[model samples]
Target: MSHLQAHAQSATKSAVRPEHGNDVSPHRFCVAPMLDWTDRHERYFLRLLSRHARLYTEMVTTGALLHGDVKRHLQFNAAEHPVALQLGGSEPDALAHCAELAEKWGYDEINLNVGCPSDRVQSGKFGACLMAEPELVADCVRAMRAATAVPVTVKSRIGIDDKDSDEFLQRFVAVVADAGCRTFIVHARIAVLQGLSPKQNRDIPPLNYPRVQRLKQRFPELQIIINGGINTLAQAQALTDGSDGIALDGVMMGREAYHNPYTLAHADQQLFAEDSAVPSRADVMAAYLPYVEAQLAQGTLLQHMTRHILGLYKGQNGGRLFRRHLSENAFRKNAGISVLKDACALADTHASLPPHEQPDDNLRNHA
Candidate 1:
């Protein structure tokens, strides 16, 4: 069967639950919900590279789903199976309604965003600020739980602003867990709500993996997945490998997965113990071509899909040549799948020759 066919057929299949002891859980290696980076096209592309990793949508606000174009926010390619929809907003009724909508649309899971620290999210009284109002977050979780059969989960920080303590995190998680949330993906840092920009909040704040580890020890029943500051394969493996008895359930990678997605090509074998050999860079490009071609035929910009694969050849021999060709031509009116074809041609040539021995003209002299 074709990739598209598998994409369609797998849409209805359920992903393994991300619980400790359920090592079969596909959520062991997830690509986090990055605002613009994990849209449908990007999810579909990433799916080609690792079939086992769970993918998440860019956070769709409750207002966008209820008051704006619902289909536009909720619709996804059939191939992005085991995909979760991350919903933003604090209104219990609105979030519950959106959760119901997500279930109706066949989403595999619904994740509540209590982790974002942006001023925009603060103005709306949700995100990390909700960390201070554990009851309100619990109510939201209760309502969403009442609305869907699929798992209702949350992504949050260890704390926010003045509440950066283990006692504070314990209270917050206890209340939300009381409301029936079993899984919590915690970014192991505090959100500096007042002076810092969201980007600064991501950095500057020291990562406290030990706090998360203590939380796991405190609430062993909860599937606690760690997020934040984990950027490389070795770092990701340390947690997911489960060798140290850390008791954490999973790993949710954001920017690392986006900026260097090729790292995920090995996620299936490492995280899920899949028997298949890891995919080659060329193999991923070849598998993704049909999806890109189909999207382009549907009037989607070539760059819309191609942009996500720019890192496909990252750190490889002829990667610059591949990136230069796609970067230069993908947005052109006449640019088609041929841009990828030519890029792959360069990728293959460089894959064979030593970097110093390879002709410089190949990357610099793209035809």
Candidate 2:
């Protein structure tokens, strides 16, 4: 293996979950709620990598739960324990109703999404727009907390537009905390609403982690999770060392999980320090194969699922061959687990390929 890959693998094996000084559960690492990116299949894949880290479902709108197929939207694997359902809404009654339904669906926690800055969300009068109305957010949190016994939490950007100030954030937290929400996942950045798109909002916003740390210091009783632009295991570990936890989204969940899955395997060993063996990409593909076939039988496109696995062999000896073979063959009519076997075979055969030829660039960019 290349030196960087070797170091990553070694770090995975040595990762340790730090003990928090507070009364919260020890699952300090969390997968952030990403729209369309953190479905059940992705959550299950992440669960295979780290058993103890908390997983969050994508933001399900309160309207969807109240009017749409709530069960299908909330469906998840049994193995994905300690999972939280993130709900998006501004209405206190609707949010409370959705939280009740999520609690009934057996989620470990109910999180409020106040961080998403999409225009569509703003038109719906929710997401980061709620940041402008702390009173409304507190009412929603209060109602949800009263409706469900599960821990009610909020995920928000540091500020929106000109409202970016410590005073705004402090009052926002204080209002919600009074409403019984104790956990706050702060995406430590100010979101620009006018010129930036939602994707740019995630990237262009300057990360102000110290502001989040200050929030933690100010409200020692609140569990503050830092999120935004944290891409490496080292970064995750370092952030969690100071904060209550670290929340990772597209950067870690999609790109990193696909490019260097071994990081997760390393996280299992180093963070959890559990002797449990990391499953090979082949093993993961084998396990997921039957599920894919079943979904296909029901007319689901392979792309829906395969898109989540494109980075499975990132940074490995035959990473490109593995990704290329799978990318080409996985969509064939009636493709099965045997396709994964072929991909693995390609990896084995091209193990001696130079690093430049092994698709690490694709892995890194996507990751």
Candidate 3:
């Protein structure tokens, strides 16, 4: 078998149903769907790191799927199995159609996006704004569940704006759960619909992890996965295993997973209890080169895929050189795998230098 196939099978081994007889959720260790970030190329790269961590597509709106290029929005590498397609729309019929499309396109799950606080999303009458209208959200969920056999999940903030009350969240979850949605990925911050930019909304709102845990406490049967501010594999493990008083069903890591992509290198072993050997950073790069080459031949721009790997060596020796080399050269016309090789070589070379012998900013600039 090819090394990639071997990695996939190895990860799947640990995903088997446990002795407890409860189905292990793919949600247990998910990488949050960030717009313009978690595309097919990035998902493919992440799969090489951990076979079992669930991946999500960026929010594709019903309008985009119905009127836009269907293939561009739906096509993905088969290696990204166990991946979900997150949809952005509140109209029941539109969402129902989208959910049907998602299942037909081979998505393992269909997630409704009710937590994004972006103005663009709000103007569409979807996203975190839906938090205020529990009944409408329920209708959307009901329609989606009717149209697709794949699990229909919802991702929402705990509350939105002045509706930041525990009772409000409870009512919302209860309504949606009654409508056949079994999983709710809660970003444990009250989305301030009016004052915050989308970027600010992610950070400015203080995280109410306790509130999410309490949500789980109230509805113990429904799968409740916590999102927002979780940064490391250790944190993901702790939250899912109930390191605190309440054991959540899962944890979703966002920017940290992207900016420090290698954080997932140990997920299969650490989170899924897999016994397979972990791939080193060098090993991951080597495995990914062939993919990059294939994409390059298929007319994908080298920069599109290379941009995702800039964080592969993040915080390691020679990491800056690795990033700098790619940032400087990957965008050049006709750039190919050679540029990536040179970047990896620079990282290796700088890491081999003695601490005192390593180049400073000035020397690195010239190098």
lDDT of 2 at 129: 82
Residues 1-367 of candidate 3 have per-residue lDDT tens digits of 4566565445445433222115556688899999999999999899888877889999999999989999999998777777899999999999999999998888889999999999999999999999988899999999999998989999999999889889999999999999998999999999999989999999999999999999999999999999999998888878888787699989999999899989998888888877878887877887788778988999999999989989988877788888988898899999989999988888887776777876774454625
The numbered model that scores best in TM-score is: 3
RMSD of each: 2.7, 6.9, 2.8
Distance from true position, residue 231, model 1, in Å? 2.0
Q: Candidate 2 or 3, higher lDDT?
A: 3
**C-alpha lDDT of all candidate models, in order:** 0.84, 0.73, 0.88
Worst 10 residues of 2 by lDDT: 246-255
Each prediction's TM-score against the native?
A: 0.93, 0.83, 0.94
lDDT tens per residue, model 1, 27-120: 6778999987999999988877777778999999999988899988999876677799999999999999999999999888899999999999
How big is the positional error of residue 230 in model 1, measured in Å on the Cα after superposition?
1.5
Model 3 worst lDDT window (10 residues): 12-21
In terms of lDDT, the best-performing candidate is: 3
Model 1 steric clash pairs = none
